[model samples]
Target chain A: MTTRTGPPAPEIRHVTVVGCGLIGTSVALALRAEGVRVTLADHDPRSLSEAVRMGAGLALAAGEPPADVVVIATPPSTVAAVLRDAQARGLGAVYTDVASTKGRILSSAELTGCDMSTYVPGHPMAGREVSGTGAARADLFAGRKWALCPGPATALLAALTVTELAALCGAQVCLLSPYAHDRAVAAVSHAPLVLSAALAARFAYTREGADVLALTGRGLYDVTRVAGSPPELWIDILEHNAEAVADMLEQVVDDLAAVGAALREADGSARWGVVADLLVRGNLGRELIVDAYARRAPAEGVELEAA
Target chain B: MTTRTGPPAPEIRHVTVVGCGLIGTSVALALRAEGVRVTLADHDPRSLSEAVRMGAGLALAAGEPPADVVVIATPPSTVAAVLRDAQARGLGAVYTDVASTKGRILSSAELTGCDMSTYVPGHPMAGREVSGTGAARADLFAGRKWALCPGPATALLAALTVTELAALCGAQVCLLSPYAHDRAVAAVSHAPLVLSAALAARFAYTREGADVLALTGRGLYDVTRVAGSPPELWIDILEHNAEAVADMLEQVVDDLAAVGAALREADGSARWGVVADLLVRGNLGRELIVDAYARRAPAEGVELEAA
Candidate 1:
C-alpha cells in the first residue's frame, strides 16, 4: 500500500461528468457556475438533452479532447464497466466516481483490469428525496461532505485533482478506506433508508385507510421523508451494500425487539428504563449528527482523514 | 358513541391556555395574532413569563372571569388531572386539550369524574424538533390537522368551540373516537418516534466515533430528525399509548426481521423481492401522507369523521 498522501488540490479548469442523473447534473451545474468547462454525457439521450437544455453543460461531441477530470456518475452496478470503457477510450486524464458504495466498485474495477492510477473513488454525502436531472440544482453539493477512497495504486496527482473538483463544487473532502466508506454510509445512509421504508410500509397495512394519516404530525413526516424516494433507485443502493446495511439493520431490529418487549410487559415501571435508555442514546446520536452538519461549512476545502 | 355532531363553529372571544410549552405557546401566539384575548397559565413561572414576553398573552390572574375556551396543553400523563382541576375552578365555558394521545387521557378524565359535557379531547398534528416557548411560532399549526375526540357526554357546544379554536389557529378539524385517534397516532407518530430512536441509538455504538456521522446526508438526517426530541416527553407519550404503540412497533419489527433475513441470505436473488416489496409499499404510504398534507388546506373547516 502507498503510504504517501497527496499535496494541496490543484486548479481545475475542465471536467467531464459521465451521467446526467441528479448528482451528475448537479455537479455539472455547480462546475458551470464556477466558469469551468463541463462536458456532459449519458446513456439516456433524453436525460442528457434535458440537462444540457437546463444550462448544465454541453453534450460531449465526437473527437473531444480529454478533460482534466472525469466523474463516473453512473449507478453503483455500472460504475466498474463504465470506468473500464471510459479508460479504454481515454475519456479523461484522471477518473473518479460518485457511487455511494465503494468497496464493491473498487473490487469490480480491479477485477475488470481498469487502471487504478487514474481512479479516485468518491461519494458526495448529499441528495434529496427526489431524483432525476429535473431536480438538479447547483447548490446540491454546497457545504456537503465528499468522501474520497484512493487505493494503493491511485496516483497522488489523480487524488489531488478530484479533491480540486470537489472544492470547485463547494464541498469538503474526507479521506478513508473503501471498507470504511461502505461501513460509514451503511450506518448513516443505507440502513436509515431501510428503516424508513420499513416504518412507512406499516402505513399501507393500516385498516383505518389513508384518512388515518391525517393524525400524522411533523415527526412521522420527517422520519419517513425518504420513503418517498424511487424504489428502483434504492433497490440498487441496498443491494450493492447489502452486508453492511444488513449488519446495521440487524442491530436496529434487536433494539426495536427489546424496546417492544419492554413496552409489552405488564410491570411497566422497570421496563420503562430500557425504552428511556434507547431514547436518550438517540438524543445523543442526533445531536452529534446536527453538530457535524453545523461544523461542515467552516471546514470546507480542508481534508479530514479517517481515524 | 355520540352520533350528535356539533353544528357550525361559534365565535371564540377569549381562550385560556393552561400550559406554556411549544404547542401551548404557539396556540397562544396564533390566537393573539387573530385578536383574541388569551390568558396563559403554567406551573413553571419561567415558561409563563417567557410566553408572555414573546407576546403570547397575559398571565391568568385570580378572580378572572371564565373564557370561552380553556386549553389544557400539558404533557399527556397530566392532562386528566389538569382538566379536573381546571373544571373545579370553572376555568371556561368549554374545555379541550392538546395532548398527542387521546384514549388513555379520556379514560383517565372519566375515572377522575371530570365534567365530560364541557370537555373535548383534541390533538393538533403539529410540533417541532425543539421544545419550550423559545421554539414556539404562530404558524405552527397552519394548514395542519386538529383532531377532536368528543365522547358521548361532550356537549355539541364544547366540540364546536374547540373547532373554532382550531380554526383560529388555521388548522383543519377532523373527528374520530378516542380509540381511533390513539391507534392512528400510534401508527403515525408515537411508533415512528420509537423506530427513529431505535435507529439513531445505533450511532452511539459506532466504533468510528462522532466523525463517522459526517457521512450522513439529508436522508439520514431527516430520518433521525425527531430522535433529538426530549426523552422524558417521549417516554410519557409512549407510556400513555403503550398498547397501540407496541402493536405498531411489533409489526415493524416483523417487517424488518423479514427484510433483514432476506438480505442476510447467501443467495440474494430470491430475497431482493422481499426488500423491494417493502420499499414499494413505503413509496405508496409516503405518497398517501404527502397527498393528505396537500389536501388539508382547501378542506379547511370541514370535519372528517372516522369511518
Candidate 2:
C-alpha cells in the first residue's frame, strides 16, 4: 500500500452499520478493530445474529444515541429506503452506503426526497464468489478502490466523515461521478461477468461439445472463474444497470467478431494481424490495471478528493 | 498433492535435457534433486551456461558419454530437428521431445525417418507467462499432467524410460495419442488463449477503451493473463496445431456469436436467457476440468494407459 503523507485525522467515535451482509460485516469488523463503538443492524435476524456472533459488532439495541456516521450497508436496490429511514430518524451526523451501483442509488434517494446533503453514495470495488456475513473479513477493503459519489450541495462534513471512514478501512478512495462509476465498472467488472457467463454457458449446452470443456487447464479455469458468481445477485446487478453494461459489451462483441472472422478466413494473414493486435491490447490493458492498483500514491496517480 | 499408493518405480539414472529453457532447466533440476545424473544442452550458449550455473545440470562437453535418456526441450518447430540430431548421434538409450503440440512433432519425426521405436513424444501441460531458464523451478511439473504419446511401434524401453522421467519429476503421466493430445489442448488451452487475446486486443485498439482497462480487477486480469505469452513462441505452436486450434475456436466462435446476438437484441429476455445458459454451462465445464485434474484415480477417471 502507498504510504499516507498527511497529518492524522480524529478517530471515529461511533459507527452504526445497517444490513449485516458481506460488506456490512467487513466494514463493522474494520471499524471495531480501530476502537470505534460499532452497532450492527439487519432485518434478517439470522444474518444479524451471525454478524454479531462473528464479532463484527455489537447488536444495535432500541433507543441508542446518534452515531457519528450511519453506513447503509444494504443492496443497491434498498439503499435509498435505508438512507431515507436513517435520515428521518436522525440516526447519524453523516451517512453513506456501499452499494455496487452509484447512479441508481442516488436517483432513488433523490426520488424519495431525502436529505441528499448528508448522504454519500459509495461502492467498495471488492468482492468474492462466496458472500454474506459468513464470508466477511476485516481486511476486505484494504488496497481496494472505494468509489464515492457525492450529489451537488452535499455537506462538506458528510463527505469528510465518509472519506474518513474509507481511510479507516485502508481503502484507496477514488472520487468518481455516479455515471463514471457505472461506466468504469461496466467496462471492467460487469462486462467480464457477462462475457464469462456467456462462454461457460455455451460450453455447458453443446451436445458434442461437452468434451471441449472436459480438457480443462489453468488457462480455461482462470478465464471462466467469474462465471461461477451467484446468478441471483448478478441478475439484480445486470438488470439495474443494463444500459452501461450493454454499451461496454457491444464493444467486446465487435472485438470478438473480428477475431472470429480472422479464424474463419482461409487466408489467415490479415485476420491473424487483427488477432495479434487484440492480444497486445489485452496485455496493455492488464498492465494498466495492475499499475493503477499497485501504486495509489505519487503525482502520476490521483489522490482522494481534497478535504 | 494426492498421495500415491504404488511401490516406488526404478529411478532414472542419467538424463540429458536439450534446449535449456524453462521446461528443460526445470526437468534437469527435478532429475538432479532425485539423485539422477543430469546434463544440459541448448542451441544458445548463454542459456546453456546459465542453466549450468543455476546447477540445473552439468553442461554437456564435446565428448560426454551418452545419457540413458535424451530430452528434446526445444520449441515446437525445432523439436523435430533436435530429436533427429540426437537419434543420428546415438546420444542416449531413448529419445523424447516436450513440445506443446504432439501431432506435428510426431509427423515431423516420421518424415525425417527417425527411429520411432526409440522415440516418445511428450508434453507437460504446465507453464508460466514468463519464459527461458531464468523462470525454471524444480517443482514446475509437480502435480501437472505430463502427456506422453508414443508411436504405434515405439520400443518398450523407450516408452518406459519416458514414463519413468514423468514419475521422477512428480508428474501424473497421462498417455494420449498425438491426435487426442492436440485436440484436447486446443479445446482447453489454444481456444481460451485466442479468446483472451481477442478481448485484450480489442481493449488496446480503442481510443477510449484504454481507460476502461485501467480500472481492471481480478476478473479481467485472470481472463487475459495468458495473452502476454511471447508472440514468437505462440506463433509456432498455433501454426503447427492450427487445425485443432481452429476446430476448437470454431465452437468458441459460435458461442461468442450467440452471446453477442443476445446482447444486441433490444428485448433481452431471449438473449438474456442465452447469456445465463452459457454461464451455467461454463460452471459445469469448469467443474469437469477440476475433477479431471484433481482426481486422477478410480475406475471413473482415466489413467496412464498400460503399455
Top-DockQ candidate index: 1
In candidate 1, which residue pairs clash?
none
TM-score of the second chain for every model: 0.94, 0.91
What are the C-alpha RMSDs, in order, of all predicted structures? Answer: 3.7, 4.2
Best by TM-score: 1
Compared with the true structure, the alpha-carbon lDDT of candidate 1 equals: 0.88
Best by lDDT: 1
Chain B, candidate 1: TM?
0.94
Specify the CAPRI tier of model 1. medium
Q: Candidate 1, fnat value?
A: 0.77
List the global CA lDDT of all models: 0.88, 0.76
Give the Cα-based TM-score of candidate 1 against the true structure. Answer: 0.92
